[model samples]
Target: MTATASSPAIIRGATLQPRPWANGLGISHNIAQHGDGACGFGWMIATAELSGDAAFSHYPGIDRVFTIIEGQGATLTLEGSGPLRCRPFVPAGFPGDQATHCTMDGIPGRAFNLMLDRAGWRGSVTAQSLAAGHRMSLRATAIHCLAGQLAIGEDVLEAGDTMLPADNVTVAAQGAAAMALVVEVAARVG
Candidate 1:
C-alpha cells in the first residue's frame, strides 16, 4: 500500500529477501532502512538467522539493539563489559563499534535487530502484548508482529509482518493474545 501521512505501508514477512551477513555466519532479512548505499544508513531494522558462533561486524559510531525472537538465546561477549545473556524476547543494546562475539546456546536462532547511527538518529525498541480486542494508538516508526495476529484498520498482520505507519496508528489484537515489537526513531538535533 502507498503510504501517506494518514496511511501505513504493510510489509508481508514472506516477501523479504534473505541476504548474507557481513560476518558470513548468518543471514538477514531487511525490513526497512532510512538511507541507502554502503555505510550510509541512518537507521535500519532487520531480522537475522545465525548459523554458528561468530564475531559481530563492527560499525563505528552506531548503536545496536538485538533481541532473540526464536529458539534458545545466545551469550554475547562485548569489549569492556562482562558477558551478557541474550534471552528470548528481551532486547540487548550495545555499541556497534565494540568488539563482540556470539556463542549459540545450542541451536542457532533468529533475532530482530535495530541499528542506528549515533550521530544522526536515535531509536528504541519495545515489546508489547495485547489481549483480543485491546486497542492502542502508537506513534512509532514500525511495528513488527511477533506472535498471534494484529489488526490495523482493515489490515491484519500475522507473525513476522511489519507495518510502517506514516502517522499515529491504532491497532488491536485479532483473536488471541498478541505480541509485537514497536520501534520508534527520530533524527538527532545538534
Candidate 2:
C-alpha cells in the first residue's frame, strides 16, 4: 500500500478493490494513498466509477485533478465557475472543497483521480500517447496506461496498469498505439 520515496511502485489493476463511497453513488479504487482513509492524507491516486449523477465528496484544503479513463465522460458543475465538460483523456483540475456535482455521460465510466493537500503538496495530470520507435521522457511521478503497452524502465505496462517511475525515467511504446495518463505530485513551495 506504500512505497518509499526513492523507489517506484507498480500497481496492477487486478489487485485494486472497489471502495464504496459514503453516499453510495459511486465507488473508488485507491492506487496509492499517503494516509489512512479514516484520517487524512497528503496525496492519493484513485480510479472511480460512477453509474449515475452524484456530488463529489468534499475534501477541505485539497486540490484535485480528474481524467476520464473510459466512456464518454461527464460534466462537472462548480459553484462559481461555468460547467466543465470532462471528456476521455482530458484532465480537469479543481478545488476539492468546491460544491461540485457530476452528471454522468449516460453510460457507466471510470476516471483517474489525483488529490493533493493544498497546504503540503500540489499535483498535475496529463495524457500521453506515443508511437512506436519514439521515446518519452517520463518525469511525472506516476502513469496509468489507457491503451496499448508501454515499456518504462524494466516494467511493461498494459492498459490499466499504474507505474510510479523513478525520476527522469524514459518510456517507449511497444507497438503503434500507446496512451496513458501521467500524474505529478510534489511538495508545495513556500
The most accurate candidate by lDDT is: 1
lDDT, each prediction: 0.89, 0.84
Tens-digit lDDT track of model 2 for 21-121? 64666899998877433228888999998777899888778888988888888999999999999998899999888889999887978899999888888
RMSD of each: 1.9, 2.3
Distance (Å) between predicted and true CA of 135, model 2? Answer: 1.5
Please identify model 2 stretches exceeding 4 Å from their true place: 1-7, 35-39
The candidate scoring highest on TM-score is 1
For residues 50-84, write the lDDT of model 1, one tens digit per residue.
77788888877889999999879999999999998
How well does each candidate superpose onto the true structure, as a TM-score? Answer: 0.93, 0.91
Which run of 10 residues does model 1 get worst, by summed lDDT?
32-41
lDDT value, candidate 1, whole model: 0.89
